[model samples]
Target: MALRKIVVLIYPGMHPFEFGVTCEAFGMDRSDDGLPVYDFVVASETEQPVPTLNGFTITTGHRFDEALDADLVIVSAGARGGTPAAVPATLAAAHANGAAVMGLCSGAFPLGEAGLLDGRRCTTHWRDAAALAARFPAAEVDPNALYVLDGRVYTSAGTAAGLDLCLHIMRAEHGAEAANVVARRMVMPAHRAGGQAQYIEAPLPPAGSDGLSELMDELLAELPAGHTVNSMAARVNMSPRTFARRFAEATGTTPHAWLLRQRVLLARRQLEAGHEPIELIARRSGFGTAALLRHHFQRHTGVAPTAYRRSFSAAGPPV
Candidate 1:
C-alpha cells in the first residue's frame, strides 16, 4: 500500500494551535516507530505566507492541487470570523474526491459553510456551538462532545480537542498501539471517552454562598445515590427557583444540566469498576431510568453504557 499523504488547508488569520497540531502530528517525522510515514503538506488557496494568531508567519508550501487525492485533508479553524464565513474551492474539491475531511473547532463552521456537515453529527467549540447550529440547520451539532465522526467526515470541538480527534484518527488508521505511541510522546491521555461534558469546567460556588462549595462537593458525592436540585436546594434552605439562579451563577450551568454531567462522570467510575448494572447505575446516578441514563450516556458519551464499561473496565479508567 502507498504511504498516505496528509494535507492541511490554511487560511488567513489562521489559528496557530489548530494547524500546528497537524504539523506536530503528521508533518514532523515519527519514523522511529517504523510505521509507514505520511507525506505532509500545507496547502492554501494562495501559496503565500499566511498570518496567524501567534504573530509569526507560516508560509504554505502547496496550493490546492497538491491537496488533490490527499488521504486526509484538514481545514483548520481561524482566530477571526472567516472561520465559518466561506469554504474555499480547494477544500470543497478535496472532500468531493474521497479524502477524509476534518474540521477542528470553529473549523467545523467552515465545513458547515461548505455544506459538508449536513445530516452529519458534528461538534465545534462550545463557544461556537450556537453559531454552528444556527449557521447550518442540517448539522447535528453536539455542543458537549469532544469530537464527532460520522462516516468519513470528522469534526472536533475546541482547540485542544484537535489532539483527541487526530489521535482518534490514528487509532482508527493504525490501531491503539500507534495512537498510544503518539499520545505518550505528546504527554497527553491516549483516549478520552465521550464528548465535551467530561471536559466541562465546573463553575465555582459564589463568594457569598458560604458553605455552598462544600455543599456542591457533597452534592457530587451524593449524586451517585440520587439527589435532586429541589432536595439539595431545600437542604440549603433556599427555594428551587432562587437556588437555580444561584447555581447557574456559581457553577456556570443550570442545576439539572450540571447534575446530569456529574452523574455521567460517576457512572463512568462505576462502569470502570465493573460492579454496577445499568439499572443500578441509573438509580444511583439520579437518572431514574436506564432509558434516560442511556440517552444521556449516548449523548454525553459517544459510546453506549455497556460498551463503555467493557472498553474502559479492562483499561482500568476513563481517560
Candidate 2:
C-alpha cells in the first residue's frame, strides 16, 4: 500500500526540529507538482497544547488514536525521561494494525519500552545509542547508521537524519524521481553518501605531525597509484608498525581503511557529475574494475554505482 496518511505524535518537551521534519515531509500540499498530498495529522496523547523544549507550545485537535489508521506513525523526539505510558500502547496498536511506525532520535525509547524494538536493528542519536542498547538489551543498535528499518519499524539518528529517513521512505514507496522532486523543493540532497560515522566527534592529530599530514595529502593527490603499508611507512620515515599505530591514534582508523574511504568518496563525486561508464569511473577512482567498484561502493554507500548514478547523475544514467 502507498503511504498517503501520516500521523506525527508530539508530546510535552519534544524537540521542535524533528517535529518540523515530519511536518515538512508529509503535511505540505504539493499536489501541483504531481505528488500525492498526504493526510497528515499532528496528534498527542490527548487533544491538548503540548509544550516544547524551547519554551513554546503547539496546540492540536487530534489525539493518539489518530495513529491507529495512519499509513505511517512518526514519534518525534522529546526530552530525556521515561517513555509516556500512552505512547507505547498507541504505537504498538498502530503497528499491529499494519501502520509503519518510526522513532526519530530519542523517540526510540518509547518503541523500546513497547517491546517493538525487540530483536530489531535500531538506532537513535549517537550520544544516546549506548543508553538505548543498555536499556533494551534485545534490540540490535547500530550507532553509526543514519537510519535503520526492520520490518515496519524505522528509527533514525539525530536531528537532520530525520530528513534522510523521510527521503528514503519517499524513494522506497514512490520512486527516485518523486524523492528527487521533494529534495529539490526542500533544497536538500536527494541522497547522502556514507553513514553517521562521518559526523562523530573524534580526537584530531597532535600539533607536531606535519610529515604524516603531508604524506596524507600526497596520497590523496595520487590515489590511483598503488600504495602499501611499507611504502607509506617509508615515505613517513617510520617503520610500518609505528606508522600503523600512530595512524590509528590520529585518524581513528587504519591507513588502508582511510585510503579506501577516500577512493569511494572520489567515485561518488565522479558518478554525480557526469555520464562516465562504471568501468572508467572505477579505474579513475583506484578500483581497477567495475566489479571491484560495485563490491566496495555498495559496502560503503549501500547502493550500486549504476543505481547511484541513476539517482544523482546530472546527465542521467548512461546508455
Candidate 3:
C-alpha cells in the first residue's frame, strides 16, 4: 500500500525523540528525490498542550478524529503501565478499517488494550515485553526482535528501533529506492537485520581482557580476508568451543554473523563511493563472488547491489 496519510497519537509524558522518528521518516520534504510526501499529522486525546516526558510541552493541534481515514496510525513512546481510556477504541477502529497500526516502545500497551495484539506476533521495548505479555495473555511477544510486523499491526523496541520499523514500512509500501533515499538523507543504514540483542549494551569484559578487544580490531581491519570460526579461535589462541562461548558473551553474536555484518557494511561503503563493478566490489568486500554478495547484501539492505548503486551512485558528489 502507498502510505499517503499518517496520524501519530501522542499523550502526556510521551518521548519527543520517539515522536520525531516518525516525523523524520514521513514528514520530511523529499520532493527533490521524487519521493511521496505523506500527510503526517500528530493527534492527542485533547487539543490542550501535552507535557512531555522531558520538562517541555508540545501542541499537536489535532484530535483523535484525524485518525479515522489515515493510512497509518502510530502510537508514540509513552508510559505504558496502563492504557489511556479513549485510545484503545480509536486504535482498534483504525486497524479494523485497514490502516496500518504501530506501537513504538511502551505504546504497545494501547494496541494490546485495543485487542489488536491478540494472537499476533508483536514486541515492545525489551524492558516492557514482560508487562505486555502478562497484560495480554494471547499475544505472542518477541522480546528479542528489533521490530515485529504481524498483519497490519507493528511494534518495535525502544527509540531508534522505531526508525527501523518506519524504514521497513517505507520499503514495503514504496520500494527500495524510496527507502534508500530517506535513509541516505538521514545518514542511517537503510536496513538492519538480526535483532535488538545487539543494541543492548552488555557489561564490559574484565580489564585484563583487552587482548580480545585488540583481536577484534584486527579482524575488522582485515575483513576483506575470509574468516572462519576456527581461524578466529586460532588467532586468539583458544579452542574453537571456548572461543565461540566467549565470542557470544562479549559480542552478543556469533563470529560468522559478525563477519557477514562487517562485510555488508564494507560493501555498502564501496557501493556509495563510486561506480565500481559489482563483481569487483563483491571480491573486495570478501564475499568472493557477485552472487554471494547479492544474497547477503539484499538480505540486509532489502535492495540488490546494482539497484542500490543506481539509486545512490549518481545522487551526489563522490565520497
lDDT of 2 by residue, 1-319 (tens): 5798899988888899999999998889998899988999988887668889898999989999999999899998986566678888899999999999999999899898878999999989988999999999999998888888899999998887899899999989989999889999997778763253324433433455737788887888898889999999999889999999988887879999888888888898899899988899899999899999899988876778877776667876456
Question: Model 3 over residues 18-73: C-alpha lDDT tens digits?
Answer: 88998899888899899987899989888789888897988878998888899899
Query: 1-319 in candidate 1: lDDT tens per residue?
Result: 1339988888777788898888877776788986557888887666568777778887766777887788788888875255523345656777788787888888886777677889999988888888888888998988988888987788888767898888888887888999889988887777875363534644555565645677877887788666677887887889888888887777778878888888888778778776566898888888889999899988877778887776557445445
Report the error of model 2 at residue 312, Å: 4.1
Query: Residue 217 of candidate 3: its Cα lDDT?
Result: 76
> For every model shown, what is its TM-score relative to the native structure?
0.72, 0.77, 0.66
Kindly give the stretch of ten consecutive residues in candidate 1 with the minimal lDDT sum. Answer: 79-88
Ranked candidates, highest lDDT first:
2, 3, 1
> Higher TM-score: candidate 1 or 2?
2
Please provide the root mean square deviation of candidate 1 (C-alpha atoms, Å): 5.5
Error of 3 at 111 (Å): 0.8
**Candidate 1: global Cα-lDDT?**
0.77
- Among these predicted structures, which one has the highest lDDT? 2
Best by TM-score: 2
Give the least accurate 10-residue stretch of model 3, judged by summed lDDT.
194-203
lDDT of 2 at 130: 91
lDDT, candidates in the order shown? 0.77, 0.85, 0.83
Q: Which runs of model 3 end up more than 4 angstroms from their true locations?
A: 194-198, 201-319
Q: After superposition, how far is residue 164 of candidate 3 from its true place, in Å?
A: 0.8
